[model samples]
Target: MTEQPRLTTREAAQRLGVKPETVYAYVSRGQLSSERAPGGRGSTFDAREVDALAGRGSRREPGTGGASGASGELSFRTGITLIDKDRYYFRGVDAVELATAYGFEDVAEWVWTGEPAHGSRFTAPQQFLDAARLAVDALPVHSSSMDRLRVAAVATAAADPLRFDLDPSAVLACGRMLIPTLVGALPTVGQHRSGEGRLARQLWQRLTSQLPDEASIRLLDTALALLIDHDLAASTLAARIAASARAHPYAVVSAGLGVLEGPLHGAASGLAHRTLAEVLERGGAAPVVADHLRSGRRVPGLGHRLYPGEDPRATALFALLGAIPQAADALAAARDVVDTTARHTALHANVDLALAVMSVAFGMPAEAGETVFAVARTAGWLAHALEEYAERPLRMRPSGHYTGPRPPRPLPA
Candidate 1:
């Protein structure tokens, strides 16, 4: 095997399509590690490392190796969804069937509390509702749903009169109550002292106000089923860790939302919307894709990490999104591209790419795609949070190395 020749930082910058200053910044930031060439002259960097650093953008900078004889963990990127037959139960239930027949509230409870399919979210006690409302009101309206939940967590912790009710079952109920207020809708009519209202009913009643049409509720329901509970994803793991801490339902949910804000997990929906908008601005799908390919651009909806084949969720949602009248022309255009661009890979649409088209066709605000994803994915977070609470907590202490010289003692002093 041949060892590849190293490149100067200047050459690496040219390959990365970034400025020389950006390349230097990457080095200083420990993103693009450099080698001291034989003469100890100007730095040389690995070309592959520089290329990777350019794509990494603003994510958590990569960590160095583990301590003596210890290995760090690596997770495979299975985009959008996960099916864990050994541990999880997605295979047993028909998600599309439930999404179509039930309203969003039923699915919400199903994911969070693992209640029966037809079960109600109304079972949460009045005290939980009171805590949720107080938390919602305490939020700065400018905050996202994820942010509002953290505010709710502190309020929930402050208000929970019960000192000993720290188990998974109780905490999960709190999650169901919290979701409606944080993401989709909030109950407005509650008296500070009213008896327990239907959590599902109040949510649906409020949802109808923001999204009056039946179709929006249906769409919201489908979205939840599609996005909920992908197994053991990084964001899911973060949620689980928070849950393992016996964080109250509010804290656990907040933690999950925080994890979802990352691009690798959750921000792809918004990016897809951006991609779709640019394509539409260019007229139709074919020319837009052709131009993008010619310019070395990525087409958002056309690829996935998990399903090298067609994503089942993407096929399902496109059917729902395509039914709307405004989507007809664009949907037709997309299909035409799919047929003609078979050369682009027999790739079927992935969830985010389909969602980009749906966001525009459904008349959702550009940011609403992410907002909706946060809402849908919260159900999965709660489920993982509940799972976390059931397990004994791991303190997540990983070992490390000290590369510096050892024990110089008081000689320097």
Candidate 2:
């Protein structure tokens, strides 16, 4: 049997001369049809339908104009989070302020249920903890923290018979348990703390060999809250797509983790870490910035597509770091890099830069920022999954526009 030709979203976007999000908008409106590619990689559009849509030069409805890689403009509605030119909002509250005022567990409950939480606590079940530990220990000793997280998610699902429950309340409850378990499952280089605090405190214990003071732990919490959700990132879309199929909550998280492991997404912070490390080792920020430009490479941790002037998250994190006397040197290096990068180009330091700065300032491992992002983003993913579950299932399938020659003359049958 001959397989029908198809176009990926990126290819369809090019054919129609529209953004990728616009292509998704077309799918959402039923202007185009799509199906899951082999292995459920992503949706593929009918090539013929896409070509037809492209010929017509489709335009989305007004008032929906915003950048999104998955859903078109505002074609898909999400009450979870909003991103503007300067600030990110989670359910009408400023994310930076929210982070400062509350722990990430509170942020998780708020975004997932749309209500501020009072004294919420997250703890892993003993059985789930034992299972997660077995799973984590099964991985190679050199596996990244994210690798452990992925394994833990799958293990958690397998251990929970009720994981298939799709009710919002059940899903939210799973999140409350899953977040802490996921953090606990990681390989902690330091001495484990005996008492309990928040997720960030526990996570800090996992990532570093040193004990963190109250101020440092608070900064880590703020960072986690700030990273909780940001509209529909690639990983979020992956999570939603999985949820749209009614996959288990743990499976939804697995989908998100799969996408986040990509270099261009979650791993981008590690790149920024390397860049900043170079600046410190060279004893001058300007030289490294100039070299990156001369090589025509993007200065890692700098520039963002959505925010023109600055990343408010970056501003907030930097402010927190500035207030901590222990972070003075790390803060100064970050500023120098920012200054040099700005002088050479219009780019501004973004959240990735901030994450890298935080990790460096706190003496964490190279991928610690990525780990934080993955953990924090799980809250957003689960929220999006809930939203997708409420909508019609399998609505994310995208139709492709065929551009190839007519089917091989019927295979000369």
Per-prediction TM-score, please?
0.65, 0.84
Per-residue error for 129 in candidate 1, Å, reads 7.2
Q: Which stretches of candidate 2 lie over 4 Å from their true place?
A: 1-74, 408-413
Clashing pairs in 1: 301-353
- The number of clashing residue pairs in each candidate reads 1, 13
Q: For residues 1-413, could you state the per-residue lDDT of candidate 1 as single tens digits?
A: 57668989688777766566766776664556788877998888876676554444322222221111111132322222335321223434555565566655676666655566564553444565477667677666676544554565555556666523667666665566555545322433223232234333333343223332445445555766666766666777777667667766666666777777776667776766765676567766788678768998666666666666666666777788667766675566556545545777676666776666666665554545565566666677767665555555654333222345778656764
TM-score, structure 1 vs. true: 0.65
Model 2: residue 14 alpha-carbon error in angstroms: 20
Model 2 TM = 0.84
